[model samples]
Target: MTTNSTEKRAVRTSVLRASFLYADGATRLTDKYHTSPIKIAKSFPLKDQLAVIVMDASPGLLEGDCYELDWQAREFSHAYITNQSYMKVHPSSTSEEAMGSSISQTFRLGDNAIIEHMPEPVMLYKDAKLHSTTSVHLGPGSVWMQAEVICPGRTLRNEQFQYAELRSSLSVYYGDELIFAQRQRVVPGQHQLAAPGCWGEMTHMASFCLFTDQLTSSQIGLIKQLVDDLPATGDHQVVVGISETERYGLVAVAASTAAWPLQEAMRYLWNHARNIVLRKESVYFMYS
Candidate 1:
């Protein structure tokens, strides 16, 4: 089936804005707005925090599609945000139209606020190109944690690393000071992604970052031990490393042949960090 031109361009750009506030002794989704193809599926209350799932109505991101998401948490509020499914990037129609899709996300937190932003893995199709940027601003005593997984084009189809390009940039600011910044650009045809000091033999990669003043050296050690304890067999080999940031918090990177192992490692470290920062247990969500 062919897509109609009008329908394809109907929602070239979509926006989602959500705000959480601590009220009535619990965190609540006080305000929210969304455009077509992007909406909040639902929000669930877990312990002292609120969990919200963002869902995309369209099949996947198409060429020229752009998504903007903004989230805010009020003082003492704790929120967890996740996507319902993989962020699928479709192939460009032609080499000349390889700019492809983009996603921009911004997060702001008030004093003592906490946010756990964990989304599903990204699946890039052959010839697909995607650019994603994330900016976070934290207030005093606030914490922000994010986890991301990137999968080399559909591996079963033998299209691994066939994408035109993938660029991701992230910046975190504590007050007016930039605590962490990272920029990654990968062009499969131009870069030796599988060579030493690069991705090596790993087909998937995951990154986790926690920004907060509550980070401790002992906590980093425990996180490293957690990553080391993950089972690494021939079928599902994974290599993960953790390090402290320039100022506060820590960053962990993992490379694996499959996404599941990386995801598992991310979850383990996320739980540990949450406990250290918020003194809370892991909150599970049912992904569709």
Candidate 2:
């Protein structure tokens, strides 16, 4: 037995069942068969935006567990997936006294389809490292949605993720046409941590909402209501904003104290989007 006090990293892979599909202006997800108990991943559509629910996947993460996520949207459909809380990444010191995790996500959208996946924040521990890559392929007339946050590893633990590294890259393609590309890298000891507004005044930072469909007056009103209900946690605050984008799209921005607030913001937007889309069917209250 190794003398190291830290527990040996646990290696786990949960092949979560497929949890996505599209309906008439709505996405239907049936959890009838879940091999992994309550850790369910389901997605639905809110107008042109996607609303996904990943139940049982809480804020904290287990060591040596590589979680795999998947998604699919039908034609003219949209969905966004969110976690209940922040994603906790424990320290795993292997190979040269360093550790990290990798998240790989791929999307397939149909013509006029759209997807917005805004999960909770990933909390890093001291010396923790992470690499996340997302690929998006859109059908003709289709749009894509996304958002993410990188917090300064467990700031409350007095152990800042010193010597940490994080790399995130995203590639979006619309019908054989590459549209967007963005990449970010943050290495604590090597990069500038206090370069005046690099990460702002707070040690914990988070962002939300990648993309939204057409920004109609109805949608704006719904967003307004959602923002107004934002909660306050004394030290953390969630800020909301919207901007006009090309393709008649409206980009919604949700910046929060951490991943928790961002998730709350996404939930609000998802609910509002759902109501607006369903209202058109007379199935719910008209969002006029």
Candidate 3:
């Protein structure tokens, strides 16, 4: 299939603008813009940065739907953002172009700023098609934590890897230098993702990026040990790997049949990294 086929889908674009600023020794939501099917709310308080949740008015994305999100974190500001629940991508016919839903997000960070963007898992129904893209640009001394999770299909309905297509891309950069990038395209009909040497029966996958300029050698070693000790294989376990990135950063990738293992692994790593940087336990981000 040509790229034009994917581009020809009817576009339903929704834009969200959000920014954080440092004020009165605390970070707050300085500016925000949203519309239907995309809502933002910040009621809980964190230790230093503001915490917010992105909400979807509709249950899930329909055919030919495209969503976009734009966020900026100014200098000396901090923020952590998450969603209310899992993202559901409904199925569509394979005979038509743009037979799926697409989501795009872009982040801009200033020097000495921090942002943690961790959304929930995405559940792809049987015969479902989805395309997702995320890009982050960071200034010197900035940090951004991002993660994405993908579920094969509705396991409760005995639907696994029945989707027609799934494509995704994530990229992080600092001053025009790409620090980390990941792209994947899965067509279960042509690829044996469940076969040996592949996902090997795993029904879920997750990827995370932790970009910061404040990690010591000792802390990095400790995190490496934790990643190495993660569960490798089981009914509800995940196999995880951690690697170093430019600018004192780390990236963790995991795959499993269940989502909890990956979620817990990410939580531990994120908290560990934050504790080392801030010199305090990251209880607020975990609880609130």
Each model's lDDT = 0.86, 0.56, 0.80
Better by TM-score, candidate 3 or 2: 3
TM-scores, all candidates, are 0.93, 0.65, 0.90
Candidate numbers, best TM-score first, in rank order: 1, 3, 2
Q: Pick the candidate with the highest lDDT.
A: 1
Q: Candidate 3: where is the Cα deviation over 4 Å?
A: 1-9, 229-235, 246-248, 284-288
Stretch of 10 with least lDDT, candidate 3: 279-288
Compare the candidates by TM-score and give the number of the best one: 1
Please report, as a residue range, the 10-residue window in candidate 1 with the lowest summed lDDT: 2-11
Residues 1-288, candidate 2: write the lDDT tens digits.
Answer: 657545454556543434345576565663334334225554445554445555645344444455555566667555556666666666656445343566666777776665656566667877666767777776766545455565676656666546367777867665676656667788777866667756554455443333333446666566556667766656677666665444324456555555556655555555455456333321121111
In candidate 2 the C-alpha lDDT for residue 233 amounts to 51
Poorly placed runs, candidate 1 (over 4 Å): 1-11, 231-234, 286-288
Better of 1 and 3 by TM-score: 1
Q: What's the C-alpha lDDT at position 191 in model 2? A: 67
Better of 2 and 3 by lDDT: 3
The lDDT ranking, best first, is: 1, 3, 2
Model 1, residue 89: displacement in angstroms? Answer: 0.6
Total clashing pairs for each candidate: 0, 10, 0
